[model samples]
Target chain A: MLWACLRFPQLAFDALRGTLPNTPGAFAVVAGPAQRRGIVFANAAARGAGVRAGQAIATAQALCPHLCLLARDPAAEQQALGAFATLAWRYSSDIHLREPDAVLLEVGASLKLFDGWPALERRLRDEIARSGFACRIAAAPTACAAQVLTFAHDGIALTTTAVLQGALAQLPLAQGGLESATVTALHGMGLRTLGDLFRLPRAELARRTGPAALLHLDRLRGHLAEACPRWQPPARFARRLEFESAAHSTTALAFPLQRLLRELELFLLARDGGVQHFVLVLGHERGASTRVAVGLLAPQRDAAHLLELARVRLERIALPAPVYSLALQVDELPPLTPPHRDLFDTRAQGGLDWPALAERLRARLGDGALHGLACVADHRPTHAWRHTPLDPAAPATRDATAPAPTANRPFWLLPQPLVLRTAPQRILAGPERIESGWWDAHDQRRDYYVVELRGGQRAWAFTEAGSRQHWTLHGWFA
Target chain B: MFTSTADLFALDSLPASTAWPVAAPATTPASAPASVPAARNTAALDTVLRHPGIWRRRAPGTSALATQPSGHAALDALLPGGGWPRGALCELLVEHDGLGECSLLLPTLAALTQARRRVVLVAPPYVPYAPALAAAGVDLRHVVQIDAAHTDTHWTAEQCLRSGCCGAVLDWLPRSDYRELRRLQLAAESSGTLGFVFRPLAAADQASPCALRLRITTAMNGTQFELLKCRGRLGGATSLRLRA
Candidate 1:
């Protein structure tokens, strides 16, 4: 199941460049030699104003007085890439994240589920439309060609190694993130195209271009195999969306759905969260509606997964008599901490990483995941207790199993009170004394005692000395 | 001698449901009365939010002046509760024609004019005791009455509650709608004024929002009042059988 990949030459940069085109401006993102805070990226706008890579700060600034300078924020780029990775992860878990900006995922596993090759293309087109930039996808039998093609301006340019080699023949050597010195050396030797370099004999090329460039060349021409690692969902966080009205038109339903799905990034970012299951509900005009839900092999809450499951399922389903509302409910929250089956695995942002877990579940499952149990004291077993929605803004639970103290707990606590057969329970214990309500007749003083023995099971009992011969059992541990 | 441990028993966990505990007589078990206060009428759903305010406060600039517009006035002057204390609660009892309920409320309203305070009426569904109130000398011209049909109870109650300048607030509503009046009663208390509530026939002398709860019925010449509840100091709910 080969899915197509279409690339839009340099649209992201183009968009950035277009922001101030024709007005002497330059842009570049400088990665600090090796640190995240380093100057790693700058726009073409900043560049036009005369800023250059590797130049000292004073020189870069002097060259372009009006340059819009910014320090590299790896976290921001990582988040952006991370969000896209989750989105792409939905198409296929087999994903390779080329940090700072790009990623590649194997969509073969999802092609059929998403309606096969051509439909997948149209679906991607329909989905990514107005998504800010054009993304090119290319699927082939090999990862080498696929990876290279994923970077091509058009879908077919990188489809075959022969065409890739042919195209590479005229391509400049520096385009592959190569050093300028290497490019100069290659250019001086008349080694321009990748194919031209390849024609120079392996040993010579390795000696001249070095292992980095050779490996790049080999990977580009489909001569080697490299795998893209799969992405993991956030650990915790709940995400749910409420629609203003029941969605009657399937085509128009993406509005609210998209906004809700967008929380996937924010929730996951808050804590290392991820989702494993998702529950989508198409709320009806009244209260009753349809539920279309599914679970994934791995946990994930990225918008891509939600959209894939929803889009595919919805395409086949007939909108239920014009839905008046729709809601996506997610649950089964987890924590950002790695499987801590062991005692140690330092975790952070704060302790007990349930927020990330909740975010993940919220992302994948909708907002319904991650519930906290609240006990309600009632004699009726059916009304004994329930799960209350936990507040995200509150502190995360270190251990959900432990009880959290609330304001004033009930004094006369009952896990479950007994159903009296007659006279409410004979006093086995008693006359212990509870006295109040002096001014009103409604007040009385009683002594509670314990009693036992028709068959020897003890029970709590209270007797009213000031009133009728009332003797009643109030509790029983057994 | 029963041992202290004798009265001890293990309790199974359960959910807690609460109710105003005043309905049960001291000698009687509260099994049925416990269910009386949770009245939320789902049948006439429209009246859910339109519920009138069961509570009120004294308008500004009136030194020691309060009003209780009982749909009647002459009856307002003779009452000892003194035309309903401001930021306080007055509970009414109704049978057919509310059993002279209109006549009993007159003096309560008349006493307010002892200073000329404006009265605010909310979502009143029944007819007023016009001639009776006029006879009692209540200044009907100083009244601002709003009538709504089957409204959302909370919204209506909230509107009247936030309107602090109204001298008094009155509403005729069923008790089962909610234990809501207590909340409004608390609001009136905080604002320092009076609230006269004509409750439905469910609770005769139950715990409610008012500092004092009265059960009034109409007699031949006037009305009869039984003090079902009193929360003020030196005051306590006594079944004071009174005829005015």
Candidate 2:
């Protein structure tokens, strides 16, 4: 099987570049504790000024007076590697990530589908370049061999096993994936290349260099049946970004928050999914993370719409403290369903994008401000209906084919039935007795009638079960 | 070219394939074969217009104003468009806040709700009693009420109308000037949604940009629908009585 290896040699610096602001001067990634730190990666400008990896920070800065130093973050580097593996998974299902740097993908099954090696290689190079990473890519018969060859050349696609072995023989042992100690020991034994090492007796080499060296040689030559752990994408998505400076106000956070949302949009688009609920966590220096959970009436994946909803939600919140980092987590991702549009609309904008507008309004106005009315099966006026939250996913309980109310009903019912002293001028309809709602604690029995008052206003009035001949105004026809 | 008046009468005697009022192509009259077929097609079109089975042009005095049926035949006749004029303002001037105004608009609003069109109520004076509206065949799931600030009432109404997200917007703006009403009229026209502005009865004398103005008053027997102002028809002369 043919395997493709993508080696990102400077991931320590490249991973942090996306989160930081674009600066003019060069920067180098420093590793280890504060007291014993050294430069691990440098930009072109830093390298041109005589800065090299594994040198003390003080020595490197003395050599290049204008060099900037940034502390390396291992968590961000891991996340970036996972993102690269996810991108590579689009081309091949079988993928294994070599931590801190590279990805190995089995591309033998994908060659014909992607229109052969050259086209697939061009696409991979273009996409990786667009993602802001410098990669050294190589394809060989085995995963380990492909990775080892990637360090020797920028782009190499050797298909046959004979050509792969021939290319490996010429590559220097220093460039192969081996510990510095192993390479030094091999050089002490007068072995300069894989060709020199291959001619030695296997048992003698194993007795001298131990099992790790022999395993390495076996894996490189496709003789070892090693089990490489395949990478699986996590069901939930969580991304974090630490800002250069703390954002004290909502306006200041908008730019970085927008960038986080754009990344999430691309993530969901690649998965062919949509999120209905997500939480934005703002990490503050002194207090706990403040979480803003943004929900939608329907699942959405569009970045612009999600940003607009987040903007409205942000307007209503007061920042508890200055935030230095932001984490976006999406726990619920449902498959996206196509939006329903009116069939006969000829307008430039299709007939009423209602679901999107509803979500926007709900975000601006709290959930308490929006509700849907539902009818309950009760004879009493007040107990007959209830308000339900506006959720599009909830199945509708009110049947459209249900029978209508038999008695005459007014459009508006008074909140509290007012006691009346006098009778009306005329009675338009007869008394309708309603005696239900016995199961619930609040029960009522009354006779309702539609009448016109003396001052020429139509109203609905009811009299109690016991004889209090005085009429009570319950509602208006309006 | 049939410049002379007598030459027009000679078209009836010409061959059926020739067009009416033939042009005088004197120089190359015999060699023009293409014009013969083109003229014959015009003649065939004329024959189609004269056919008894076809309806040639609409009859005069038949109104063509687009309307949404008010669901009441007698009220539809009183309306200028034979129903409620859509995409225009309809002002309901009430003597009192509860003088059967909701009853008058319940039918139209219910139809819109059942059609899956959203009905928005902006700053309603009281909580919309759910049971009553549900009993009247109004789908409650499609109803949305906005309790906006007094300063934002007009702005909210205008936005809801302009958004095209609502099939009808019922705003209770008891006090508004000419400019505010005009903005709402334009918003309704642009979005093609019905905008109903409920105002006090005292505003009847003030001129409005609404297409239909109704003054509802309660009477001893029933309710009165007084057509105070209609866009293209005389007002105050036509009134209807309904048993509320």
Q: Which candidate is the best by DockQ?
A: 2
DockQ score for candidate 1: 0.01
The residue pairs in collision within model 2 are: B1-B24
Q: Looking at model 2, what is the TM-score of chain A?
A: 0.83
Highest-scoring model, lDDT: 2
**Chain B TM-score for all candidates, comma-separated:** 0.57, 0.73
lDDT (Cα, tens digit) per residue for candidate 1, span A1-478? 2333344433334334323445544655444554333234446666666665667666766877765655455554455556556556556767666543456656668866988666766666565454555566666544544545454434442334466566666655665446678889989987765557767889988898789878876766657765555567554433445555556677666666676666754455444566556666777765777787655434455666456556655555687576766666666655433332336532222222333333333333344433433344332212333445545343432334422332211112233333334443334333455666565454655655554424333444455655434555444322
Residue range A301-414, candidate 2, lDDT tens digits: 998888888878877799989989888999978999868666986332443366775775677665566666666666787877666677766665565643465446766677
lDDT of 2 by residue, B1-244 (tens): 1111222132443455534444345575676777775576667767644422222244422444457788888888787557787777899999875577877778888999999788998878766777667767788878987767677688778877877878889999988997999899878877778889999999988877776789998775667888876654433347888863
Estimate TM-scores for all models: 0.37, 0.81
lDDT of 2: 0.79
How well does candidate 1 score on lDDT at residue A425? 30
> What CAPRI class is candidate 2?
acceptable
Interface RMSD of each: 27.2, 2.7
Single out the weakest 10-residue window by summed lDDT for candidate 2 chain B.
B1-10
